[model samples]
Target: MTDVSRKGSLSFLNPFKTRSGSRSSSRASSVVDFKIGDDARKSSISTATIKETNSSGRTSRAGSAKNSLEYTRSSRQGSTLATTGEDGWDRDAQTGERKDHTDLLHSLVDESTAESLADKAQAMFIGIPAKPAADLFSRFPEGVWRRIVEFLGPADKASLAFSCKPFRTLLGTRSWTDLNSPQNRDAKFDFLGRLDEQLPNHLLCFQCGIYHVRTQKGQEVLRPTNVSNPIFNCPNVFNLENKVARHRITVGRALPFPFVQLILRGQKYSPEHGIPIDSMSRRYKDRDGEWTHQTRYVVVNGHLLMRVISSAFATPALPPAGLRRLLYSPSDNFNPYFSVCAHWRDGNLMPAVKCALSHIPKPPEGSGIAGTSAKVQYHFHRPHPIITLCSECRPMRRCPECPTEYLIEMRVQEDRSDPDPRKLFKHAVVVTRWSDLGDGSSPKSLEWAACNGEAEYDSFTALGKRAISGTFESQFTVDQIPGQKMVSMNPNKIKLGEKGHDWY
Candidate 1:
């Protein structure tokens, strides 16, 4: 038979034998043989292993094999066979032409063996035994898992928790308190460390885990230089720190406190100086309930002296529209309502105070006093004292139409050595009902439409006696102090709300 005719009848017995009664030349001296199974029934090779031979018929190049032999597999039913053609090419028999050699060496097994052989083939390809899928996260200890989770950002952690049931259960099941619990001591430190790494000192309140806007420039005046120091020395820093420490102690670890007080003097002082407006309208039930709106103002020294006269103008550099409109409006007039100021020099809390002189909820001292009264208290540290004033009253006015008036009184000493400072001066308006109080009154002192106590009255505030009355002290605390101690001397009460004194 011809080469083509012999190719059709060739079997596993003598695959390279020719019909012309001759042996086909072997490409390599070493012949590799393969067998599918021990079945006596018809068997077929599934892949055509081919290698190009040189003209001299020596062994082929190191990696010239075009096809590889897959492990032989069989079943009781039957098997399909595959072999190369005599022309030394793989061909599609129906097309009678050579086929491309890119196809993989895969087998066509009988129905009974298909699933078994498939699994075996897959396992061999992956180089692993078949088993049920397992949870990769559960395999690790909780500590390792927490470390991994800590590495992710808040957004990333949230996303991860949402991706799968197991992850959600692992992360969401723990409350914030649980995550911060003493049992997870390492985790709390890790969290704090991460916070330190990511959050800037100004933005972070290390004491309470609270974040604040760095609204004013130069807000942070002092920082503890001793890295070994466990507590923040500054009050502002420590106040927040103390709050956070208490919280963490309840939930997890207690932060060391009453830490050393290391005051660094000479740092720049940043004051919250700006315009604050308060306005409200009400109908007096006693006078046919007529609606009357009242607006009050607190003018900062910067707006009064600097920006008002500057030729160079920017929208932000201009005074608040409310302030400008109140100043220029017809019928409405400029009035000085309230003034409060605090000063700091070289890190020392040089005398700071608040004065309540006007708008006090009183019946002109004897106009028929009602069972109502109010008081204010101030607190401080070094740079400045944080002062909070809260008052309550119960209808102290003779006429229901008249609201009760209240005052804030604060007096600080200047030149501490002075036995007496000429009266007192106020940096801010203690009280006034007039929104138009921006004019007529000297920018140096706060004035009012009328004074109840001429010598004692500084400003005024109007509140319903029956409504809100509670002595609410300002929760103020000085955040910084001068490191060196200065002799606080015979300071006299600085004249406040006085005409000639300069408080700013």
Candidate 2:
């Protein structure tokens, strides 16, 4: 009643086929046919399983290029999961090796400080192409890229050069070679047509007084002074020359205030009346009746020092007009100060902006108040910031080893209350910064510091003979050594004695 016939027929088909041989002959025959069909189906499934495994293995091998660990481990982990049809495509691989690989990559990315990497990450997030900067730069034509770099200044060129190899090479090319090179520096100075063109931006050397302009690559470079380029013996040395003489600019030292004050006092009094200052002096009169004499005044370490070199006064005439006349004029000889002469000779035109003082001279007593002297009042000109040579000494001996030749000995002497006209020009040179003469036009009149007493026309007219002004006048006159001198001069030697033989 419960389908006993159907149950008996299905029993013959079981792997452990039911042993019902006597049950029915038809059932026996049916069991043999079913066995043949089941065997065929089992064989087909086994073949398909083998094919699927091989195909998955091949797929894993191919994908190992990108995600090698995942592919290899999935294969070794077994085909049970695949055959069983589980979703394990993105499953993690064996822990140790996989973790190490991930950590190394992460550390590498974190270590770099380049903004480009961060930019690339941002680009990745924003769906932009994260092409490398070097690659992008490489895409441009070399000439075009070079042209872009040409416009950058000293600082910008440095930053760009460090960015990539191409930029560095571009800078090394002739267009941007080392700025400190002799050729480059000479060209730069010549092209600008003025030495002071780059002065404001340059750094003043602490060892020498040269204001060094930095290279385009942002390097503080100096042209090496070898035997071939024997301009100055030391690279640190900067030579400043003028009509007066070559002044070796060394590190400026602080001058004593009392000493400077003494110099100022002497300069304030004229040598003829009181004691004429030996250094060159100029007198200027304004539209009003006031007289002013311009000389070198330096304020160093907040102390005022009056420094006077042996310079000659200029004959009263119209000041030089135009840049050429002002720079190269032979008659421009009012260089009592070193700084003033240096600047004037270097073609700086700032001091040339002179205006006559406001105080015009009133006629002296007698002759119904008529101006007695032809040049009653002096016309004052503003002094230059940079000083040059005031006068050239007679050519003397030069140093044999060095390019130096002794021109003239400039004396720096100290005078304290012992009034003697014979003992002057006997001290060390003390250079300092010049005080600013505000635009050459001041409401107040400039006072004649060295010639304050009754002015003597004869002493004023003397070019190089007024010797009582400086700290010491003719007490000691030392001569500079020539570069080619075989031997040094000894004052103690030479048996020639004074005619009177006055040793005492």
Candidate 3:
């Protein structure tokens, strides 16, 4: 509708429509000109023309009616009109009171740069400190930061000092000096290991506590134990007295500490820093004994886990001497061809395998001797190919000295080399060992050392009821292997090595 705004100027007043879809006579409200942009939340609607008419219908103050903009809304009870002037003053036109001041955080950014409510809420919930809008850390004295640095370990202290130049200046170079000391070599290794992500082309040499250039880089491949496969040209590699760290995987396979480092680095950080744990897996056959081995790995709780399946066919109804040759590598260290913990001889591991092997069903042999006819006829009855062990050997066996678990199973597999079609399949003894190789942090790690028979370890107290076998197998096979029975290799808590007759 039309109305005399002020100074006899004709202005358009927006009509208030009722529910009946018709304009209704509205209450007399003061006119406030506001340049309302499309976004009312961010526009400077208050900074516009302001005019008030008294009860006598006389204009108290007025601006250029030809250029001033006007806006209208349904005025409700307890609602004051928004008004501002050319001077950009924020105040309530009705109460004539100034607007409240914005706080330090809000004042930094104007409405144009203001963060959305969702972004602000996310920042608050995530505890991300607002960008250095102020230098709060500078208020603290060097002595206070030094005290904080003293409480941290060598690695953490170095990390804090290396975080930023201000921190480096405050914490001083003492942390770096402490990390360089020989006594804190492990801490130095830990600190260097953290930089694996940043130094993808380099690998942390734990022995030297430095990042050596990755000589092989992406071309790194796991070779046999005897093969010289060096991922990095470390000074400690050829030092006979100071041997590079390694763990025995099987008879001819050794997992170098560098591979373990790279594997875990890939898992913990990025693929460029190290190789994938799946790449470390392998399947190979032993030159002797016709034993086949398949190795797989899994990372859990930051520790590298290994599972090796070694299977070889056993002649049915073999003698004790024959069982010895099948189980032990007499030509080598006399250790089992299958993967085993260092303390295998000190416990019932060998005895348990012998028991499992004895359960194999013996095939009947009928070669009749010539009685009166002087002719010979041969007949042999084949036994059931599938063999299942008794309750004693079937359960999973854990090494009390280390984080290693073993499960022996008998499966009838086709003997591809067997020429006779009738004897194509045979019962094979499969020994699967699951072990924890530690976190690849250092060479002297308890699990790694205990696995190599260098350090003492108590697997029961450390591992509790959770079996490594179950943890690793659950990654791929969806609980196909049951680990209900986990007993110590040394139930009697014995400590006899090769001196004991049972192991042999």
Candidate 4:
């Protein structure tokens, strides 16, 4: 019964103990081999056998079992054959054999491959002799070269082509073509087009008022003239009779491109006293206690351009309110008419004339009523052809008969016996031809005329005549014109005394 029980126990535990013992012993053997420096040979063999067993086992358990039993028997016999005292020596021998086999395998495959690659590289390098550093362009086809050129920046592309002859030939061709291409030419044209668009329209002159047109040739033309006449018989000519009746008129014609015509009227002032008023003044008081005014028109290019007149001078007897209302009335308002005819002409508007007119009071010249004897002079003097006013007054037109000269003068109007009268007036006058002096074309020949109370004529014409006649002739030459001399005024020289006060 004990034997039977022992057999049953063995049947149950034997398989498990055997498998466990074999795995543990294999692990222990690998550890021992590693300590003795013989692990490489043994580990390789053991791994190969295990891998084979695993692979074969998947086919059939019966075959795996047969191999396992055979492996156990061989392991036992080999262990017995291995001398206990000579284990280390045998391990070293096996290790040397495994190393030799590995080296032979590597020599058969890796050595030949490495040697062939080295020879091929050496041959290519020798065949393609080294030249000066060059671009990759020669190595690539034309299409690929174009793509490389496109990818390269301006500076890099230039350097690559210039570095070597072969690269230069390849890159230079495309570079030259690119520079002269139609696309490049079109780009230049587009740049010029933008520049042209930024330029302003130019003014052109015809028989009529000025017209605005493009700078380009054959540009659209738009003329501003009188619109009353639908058909412009002579578009450039100024008709005085028609202008006086309807003031100024502008006519425009649309060219290739439709354009709007803008007409700007000139500034106007009163004709009586040469004061600018809102409306034209019919009557004016003179120094002789007389009331009269004359309307004079200037025609340019056959068009009535400017009309000059004076405002009505009020007497001391008129009421202040009445004079104020009369001067302030809208009917007395006036603006000068400026007509332009040509484009690109210098000096479109006269700055001197504009400055002179700017000082004139708007609409009303004085605050007092009409007929008031409040002493009032014209806000501005008459416009003279010879006197150059400002930068805008270039190419001034001077009368051959009467040349003009400018003078600055100061005067004090004091009642008799008044100790401290504060009625001082300073004035700048541009005097015209006094007594038919030769044309005032040269500064050396120009003379200065006096503007004082004792002068014969109060008008600019009379003053001009007096100056030309040399009524107050002095030893000084034309070069002695006032304001021509420069002097430095020291602050210490200024005096607070009444008599010295007039020196300023």
Local distance difference test values of all predictions, in order: 0.28, 0.31, 0.75, 0.31
lDDT by residue for model 1 over 54-119, one digit each (tens)?
323443543224212222233212243234335777665445567654443333234435676778
The ten-residue window of minimal lDDT in model 4 covers 255-264
Per-residue lDDT of 292 in model 3: 92
lDDT, residue 142, candidate 1? 69
Global fold similarity of model 4 (TM-score):
0.15
TM-score for all predictions?
A: 0.15, 0.19, 0.69, 0.15
Whose TM-score is higher: candidate 2's or candidate 3's?
3
Worst 10 residues of 1 by lDDT: 305-314
Candidate whose lDDT is highest: 3
Cα distance off (Å), candidate 3, residue 240: 1.7
lDDT of 2 by residue, 1-504 (tens): 569888877785754332322333223223223334556576554454345435443333333244445545766667766675445343334322222357768778887644677788776668665666678778888899778877765445655665667677767644334544555543333223222322433332322324444222122112212212222233533334311111221111112111222233334432221112233233222222111223344322222323333221121233334222322223223222222212122211122111110111222334433433423431233233122322222222211111111222222344433377654322222222122111111111121211211122122233222222221211232122122212211113222222212110
